[model samples]
Target chain A: MEWRWDFTIEILPRMLSAMLNTLLAAGIGYTIALVVGLIFLLGQRTKFRLCNWIVRECVEFIRSTPLIVQLFFVYFVAPQFGLVLSAWVSAMLTIGLHYGTYLSEVYRGGLEAIPRGQWEACRALNLSPARTYFRVLIPQALPASLPGMGNYLVGIFKDTPMLSTIGVVELMHTANALGAETYRYLEPYTMVGFMFLIISLPTAAWLRKFERYVGRSMGITK
Target chain B: MSTQNHPLELPEGSPLVRFSGVTKRYGDLTVLDNLDLDVGAHEMVSVIGPSGSGKTTVLRMLMTLEKIDEGVIYVDGKPLSHMERNGQLEFANEKYLRTQRTNIGMVFQQFNLFPHMTALENCIEAPINVLGMKRDEAEERALNLLDMVGMLEKKDQHPTRLSGGQQQRVAIARALAMRPKVMLLDEVTSALDPEVIGEVLNVIRALNSEHKLTMLMVTHQMGFAREISDRVCFFYEGKIAEQGTPDQIFNDPQNERTKQFLSAVLDAN
Candidate 1:
C-alpha cells in the first residue's frame, strides 16, 4: 500500500477532531484513577484487617485481569443486570478502576519509602494523625510518587485506544470507521499512530520536568 | 501546663516522671525488665550502658513511642500510658496520650528533622499545628530557640543543607519549642562526628546549667555525662546496674558491671 499525500491530507481534520475525544477520555479517566487510587490506598492502610484484605484482593483481581475484559464486562455485562451504561461511561469507569489499582501500589511504595524516623518525629512533635498524614507524609510521598504517576499518565493515554473496542468515538474508533468507509487502512492507522506519538513524547518530557520541579520545591533536592 | 487540669491526684513530692516496674518485651527478648526510674523536677539524669542494655528504651518508653508490656509510666504525676477511669487505671486512648504527651519532647540520635521544612519551620510546625499557637507567636518562640541552639543563621535552611551537629541542634530546639517539661535525649550526640560533638554537647550543657527543664539522656559519652548530669544511671541487661551522682558513679563505681563497663569505655577513649 502506497503512502498517499492526498488521502492523508483528506483525513487529517477528522483525525485531529477525534484526538479531542481521546484526550478527554484519558484526562477524565486519569482524574478518576487518582481519586480511586487514594481510596484504595486508604483501604489498605486502615486498621480494619478485613476491609484491607478485601480492598487488596479487589485491587489484585482488577490488576491481574485484562483491561479489555474489564471494559467489556462493564459495557456489555452491566445492561443484563439492569444497569445500562453508555460506552463513554463504561470506558471511563473501567479505565479508572483498572489503572487505579496500579496507582495505589505506586502510592504505597512512595509512602513506604519514607523513613520510620519521620513518623517518630511527627509523634514526638505531637502532631495529630490527620495533620501528620496530610501535611507531612503526603507531600513527601508526592516526590517519590511522581515518576510512577507520570508513567501511568502515558499508560492511560495509550490505553485509550482500548476504548474504541467498546464503540467509544475516540481517536481509534474514528480511525477504524474511516478505514472501513474508505477501504484504506494505511492513512487513518498511520495518522492515529502519529497523533499518539506527538502527544505521548512531549507528555513524558513534561512529566520529567514536573517531577524535578516537585522535588526542588519540596526541598528534597538542593 | 495542662497538668493542673487532670483529675488524678499526685503524691506529695512525687517526681515529675516515674517509671514504675515497667517491662518491655519484643517477642521472647525483654528490652526492659521491671525497670523503675524517676526524674525529679528540674533534674538532669544521664543513662549510660552497653548496646542492648535498654538505655535508649528508657527514653523511648518515656516518650510513649513504645508500649510497655507491664507497669505504668507517670508524667507530671499522672499516668502517661494509662488513664484514671473510675479511680482505676485503664490503657489511655489516643486522645489522652496526645494531651499528656504535650509535656514531653524527644530528640532522636538520627536528628529526624522534617527534611521538607527549614530549621525555623521544623521548630514551629508542632507549636502552631498541635498547640494552636499563632504563626507569628510560634515563629517568635522558634527563632529564640534557634538562637539558643546557635542555629539562628541557618533558620531558613532545610535539614539536608545542614550538618549532622547543626541538624541535631535544630532538633533540640524543635523539641524545646513545645515548652516540654521533660526532654528526652536519646543518644543525641552519637550521630555526630567528634569535631561537632562538642557543639551539640555545649548547647546541651547550656540547657543543663541555664534552663530549669528536666532532662533524661541516654549517652555513651561518659566524660560529658559526668560533667553535666545531676545523676548518672548505669544500665546493664535491662536494669540500672548502678545510679548515683556523676562523681560517685564515674569515680567510686561500686558495682562490678559498672567498673568493667567504665574501664572498657574509658580505655577506648
Candidate 2:
C-alpha cells in the first residue's frame, strides 16, 4: 500500500478523537482496579482463615486467567445466564478484575516491605489496629508501592486496546471502523501504533520521575 | 545454670511489673519456660543471657508483642494475658490488652522509629491520637521529651536523617511522651556504633537516675548493667538460671551456667 499524506491528514482528527475514549477507558478502568485491589488486599489481610483462603484463591484464579478470556466471558457469556451488561460495562469489569488481582500483589509487597519492627512500635505506642494500619503502615507502604502501581497504570493503558475485541468504541475500535469504511489499512493502524508509542513512552518516563519524587517526599533516603 | 537462687522479692505494695510462670513458644521451640520475675516501683533490673535464653522475650511479652502460650503476666496487679469473665479465665481480647498495655513502653534494638514522620511528629502521634491529648498539649509534651533526650534540634528531622545512637535517643523520647510507668530496653545500644553507644547509654543513665520509671533492660554491656541495674539476671535455656545484685551475679555467680555464660561474654569483649 502506498503512503498517502492527504489520507493520513484526513484521518488524524478522527484518530485523535478516538484517543479520548481510549484514555477514558484506561482512567476509569484503572480507578476501578485501584479500589478493587484494596478490597482484595483487605481480604488477604483478614484473619479469618476461610475468608482469606477463598479471596486468595479467587485472586489467583483471576491472575492466572488471561484478560481476553475474562473479557469474552463477561461480554459474550453473561447474556445466556440472563445477566446482560453493556459492552463498556463488561469491558470495564473484566479489565478491573484482571488488573485488580495484579494490583493487590503490588499492595501486598508494599505492606510486607515495611519492617515487623514498625508494627511492634505501633503496638508499643498502644495504637489501635485500625489506627496502626491507616496512620503508620499504609503511608510507609505507599512509597514502596508507587513504582509498581505506576507501571500498572501504563499497563492498563496499553491493555485498553484489548477492549476493542469486545466492541468498545476506543482508539482501536475507531481505527478498525475507519479501515472497514475506507478500504485502507495502512494509515489508521500505523497511527494507532504511533499514538500509543508516543503516549506510553513519556508516561513511563514521568512515572519514573514520580517514583523518585515519592520516595524523597516520604523521607526515604535510599 | 550458675545462679539458681531467684532473688526477686515482690515488695509489700504491689510491684510495678511481674511475670509469673509465663511461657512462650514458637511452634515446638519454647522461648520462655515457666519464667517468673518481678520489678518493684522505680527499680532498675537488667537481664543478661546467651542468645536463645528468653531475655528479649520477657520484654516482648510485657509489650504485648508476643502472645503468652501459658501462664499469666501481671502489670500493676492486674492479669495481662487473660481476663476474668463470670469467675472463669478467658484469653483477654484486643480491647482489654490495649487498655492494659498503656502503662509499658519499649525501645527496640533496631530503634524502630517511624521513618515517614519527623522525630517530633513520631513523639506526638500516639499521645494525640491514643491519649486524646490536645494537639498543642501533645506537642508541648513531645518537645519537652525531645529536649530531655537532647534531640530538640533534630525534632524536625525524619528518623532516616539521624544516626543509630541519635535515632535511639529519639526513640527513648518518643516512648517517654506516653508517660509509661515502665520502660523495656531491649538491646537499644546493640545497633549503635561503638563511639555513639556512649550517647545512647548516657540518655539511659539519665533516665534511670533522674526519673523513677521502672526499667527492665536486656543488655550485653556488662559494665553498664553493673553500674545502673539494682539487680541483674542470667537466663539460660528459657529460664532465669541466676539473679541477684549486680555484684552477686557478676562477682559471685551462683549457677554454673551463669558463670560459664559470663566468662564467655567477657572473653568476647
Candidate 3:
C-alpha cells in the first residue's frame, strides 16, 4: 500500500532487462504483422473469389474476437492438435496475426484514399502493374498509412503484457514474479506503469514527427 | 469479347486511330452507342457536346480507360481492347493491353499529376519506369517538354504548389514525355480558372502547330476548338450528330442538334 524506494531500486535491474524482452517482442511482432498485413491485402485483392472470401472472413473473424482468447487458442489449443509451439513462437504468431488484421485495414484505407485518376494516369502512361503499385501507389499510400501504422505500433507495445499469459517472461511477467516473491506489489507494478508511460509518450511524439517528415519528403505536403 | 474470323478490315489509307462500331454501356445506359470514328496521323480532332453526350467517353475508350461492350478500337491499326489469337478475335489480356497502351497518352480534366512528384519528376517518371530510358535521357526529354509547356521555371514544384493551369501544363508535358503516337485530352481545360484557361489553350495551340501531335480533344471551348481543330465533331445521344472541317461546323453548321448546341454554347458566351 505504501511506496518503497529501496525495493524499487533492488528490482530495477531485473525490470530493465525484462523491458528489453518486451521491446524485442514488440519489434518482431510488428514486423511480422506488417508483412502479414500485406499478404492479407493481396489475398483480398486476388482474382479468385473463393480465396478473397476466405481471407476476408479470416480477417473479420480474427478482428471480431478478443485478442486474449486468440492468444489462448494459439498457445493452448495448437498443442492438442500435435502442432506444439514454444511460448515465444506462439506469442509472436498470435500477436502478429491479431494485429495484422488491423494493419491490413489501415493499408486498405490508405490505398483507397488515392484518387482514381492516379491509376488512370499510370495506365495511360503504360506503367506495368508492379511499377504502378510499388512506385506510385505505395509511396502515396505510405503517408496516409503512417498515422494508423504508428498507432498500432504503440498498441502492440501496450499489448505486450498479453504475452506474459503465455509465459514469454517479458516486462509484465517480471513484474508479477517480483511482486509474488517479495510480497510487495506496489513498487513493482508502479515501476512497470512508469516504465510504459516513459517509453510510450516519447514514441507517440516521435511518430508524429516521422509522419510529417514522410509527407514532406514525398512532396504530398509543403 | 467479339470473335471475328477475318482480320480487322481497316479503311483505305488507314487512320492512326479507328473506333469501329464501338459500344459502351453502363448498366441500362449506353454511353457510347455503335460509334465509328477516326483520327489520321498528325490530325487534331475536337469533340464538343453537353455533358452525358459521350464526348469524354470517346477519349476514355481510345485511352483504354473504359472497355467497350461491343466492337473494337484500333490504335496504330491494331485492336486495342481485343487481340487476334489463332486468327480469331478475343478480349485482350493485360499483357497485350500494356504493350499496346504505350502508343497512347492522355491529359485529364483534373490534371492527375502525381502529387508526390515535382513537375519534372512527373514528366520523367513514365519514361524512366515504363519506357526503360536511362535516367539522364529521361530527364533531358522531360526538361525539354517542361520548357515547351512553359513550366520549366516551376519544374521543381509539386502539383499542390502549382496553380491549376500550371498543373495541367505539367500534365501535358508528362504525357508528351512518353512520346506517344496519339494524345487524348479529356477536357483538359475544364478544371482551370478563367484567366489560366488561356495559358493552357495557348500551350495546346503551340502543340498543334509546332509538334503536329495526333490529338483527340474533348472540350467546351467552342472558339478555341473552332480555331485549331482539323475536324470538329458534335456529339449527341452517344453519337456524332455532325462532323466537318472547323469552318463548316462552326460557321456553316448543318445538323439541327449542332445548330442548337453551337447557338446555346455561343449564346452563353
TM-score head-to-head 1 vs 2, winner: 1
Where model 1 places Cα greater than 4 Å from the true spot, the runs are B1-9
* DockQ, cand. 1: 0.80
Per-residue lDDT over B118-170 for candidate 2, one digit per residue giving the tens place of the 0 to 100 score: 99999999999999999999999999999999999999999889999999999
Write one digit per residue (lDDT tens) for candidate 3, span A1-222: 778888888999999999999999999999999999988987898779999999999999999999899999988998899988999999889889989999999999999999999999989998887788888898899999999999999999999998999899999999999989989998888888999999999999999999999999888998
Off by over 4 Å in 3: B1-6, B9-12
Better of 1 and 3 by DockQ: 3
lDDT of 1 by residue, A119-141 (tens): 99999889988899888888889
Q: What is the lDDT of residue A169 in candidate 2?
A: 89
Please provide, for model 2 over A1-222, each residue's C-alpha lDDT reduced to its tens digit, 9 standing for 90 to 100. Answer: 799999999999999998999999999999999989989998977879899999999999999999999999998998999989999999889888888999999999999999999999999999987899888998899988888999999999999989999999889999999999999999999999999999999998998898888778878755
Q: Which residue pairs does candidate 1 place in steric collision? A: none
TM-score of each: 0.97, 0.95, 0.97
